[model samples]
Target: MSDYKAFRVELKDKIAHVAINRPDKFNAMNADFWTEIVDIFRWVDETDEVRVVVLSGVGKHFSAGIDLGMLAAGTHKYGKDVGRNAELQRRVILKLQGSINAVDNCRKPVLAAIQGYCLGGGIDLITACDMRYATVDAQLSIREVDMGLAADIGTLQRLPRIIGDGLARELAYTARTINGEEARSIGLVNRTYADHDALQAGVLEIAQEIAGKSPIAVRGTKRMLDYMRDHSIDDGLEYIATWNAAMLQSEDLRIAMTAFMNKQKPEFAD
Candidate 1:
């Protein structure tokens, strides 16, 4: 695993656990922090050994939004270095988007385990995951309104589809904090745990369950589902067929078929 100053990457049993390590700062993303995040995600995606990735924070809160100290001091400012400002601005936005997009776009499935305060950018990260679990103490908000900006990362886009558009809008506009129980009721979180330890354990267990499946089939399923949600039935069918055409030739197909025939477990070689 690549080293990170603001995070730790632990890989075991084909699962990657990435923990935000800025507990003293509430896990806020600083320039160096997000740089580490981007690199680690790219590293994780490049490996076949990693089948599932889980994101969590190590602190009393997931994050207290972007660092206000940094914001007030304009640490987010960008300059194009003598005529690159415009492109730099776009690149900056893309890079920030990438903090979560890297997680979303990883080949393997990702699960976010949230605890304590999940605000602003934290919402962006969790929303991009394939699934989310939160602790009872979790407090979440689409906090961009208070920060004088829009939720530019992924939350504004993906959250509307997960929770209703109305709920997403209300949260964005009001910037109200909602606890984990309400988050579960509104479909923002797939499950809830009584505390941080349970939250992490639950997500890890779920990740292992997914890891036990056929990697090719599992990854393809995630990709096809994403396509189906965005495309018409006809388009989706053509895409899925195209995807399975090559995947069906793999040894995994033979293993699964033989396992069924023999009434035994399939041991897929990833």
Candidate 2:
């Protein structure tokens, strides 16, 4: 494992586990932490070695959201630091947005294993993932409203696509916590585990299942699904038609079809 203050990343057998490591601070995102997150996504995509990602946080809570100190720092606008500092504040927000985008943009599937308090910026971080699972004791919320702001990252956009506008609006407007069972019922979470250990095991099970699939098919599916999320059905049809123009001719497709016809398992080559 590499040394990182904000997070820890380890890769093995086509799976990557990313743990938010600022436990003392409830895995809070302070500027550098978000920047590191963006870098991690870029690195994973570049290496192409990781087929799936399991995201979790160290300690009691998945995350308590953005660090309070960083939020307070924005109030520095009232002081004599209005020149460069204002620009710095905007930059910080942009970087945080970029961090969320990194996760969403990764072609590999991502599974979030949440526990404890996953609030505010934590909600933003997670809405970008492909799937979410939680411990029964977990509490989740879009806490930004409680902070006098809206969820400015990927959550406000991608979340509605997953859970629909009604639930997303309710969570953002009320700033209320949702437990794992409720989260699962409402589609905010896929399932609930009895505890952290169980949650971790479940996360690994799902990640490995995804890692076992053909990378080309999985990546193409994720891309197509993301595209279809915002596009009209006609648009999606045309988009995929263009996509499959060449992909349908890949050797893997031929092998898969032949194997299926012969009642044999596929042998996809990288």
Against the true structure, candidate 2 reaches a TM-score of: 0.91
Distance from true location, Cα of 153 in model 1, Å: 1.5
lDDT tens digits, residues 180-213, model 1?
Answer: 9999999999999999888888999999989988
Give model 1's clash tally: 2
RMSD of each: 2.5, 2.3
Give each model's whole-structure lDDT.
0.86, 0.86
**Which residue pairs overlap in candidate 1's backbone?**
80-84, 80-85
Cα lDDT, model 1, residue 90: 68
Q: Put down candidate 2 lDDT per residue, 1-270, tens digits, no spaces.
A: 456779999998789899999998989888678778878888778776788999999999999988989878777665566777778767867877888889989988989999999998898888899999999889998888887877787778877888899998998899889999999998989999999999999899989777876778888889999898779999999998999897888887888788889998775654
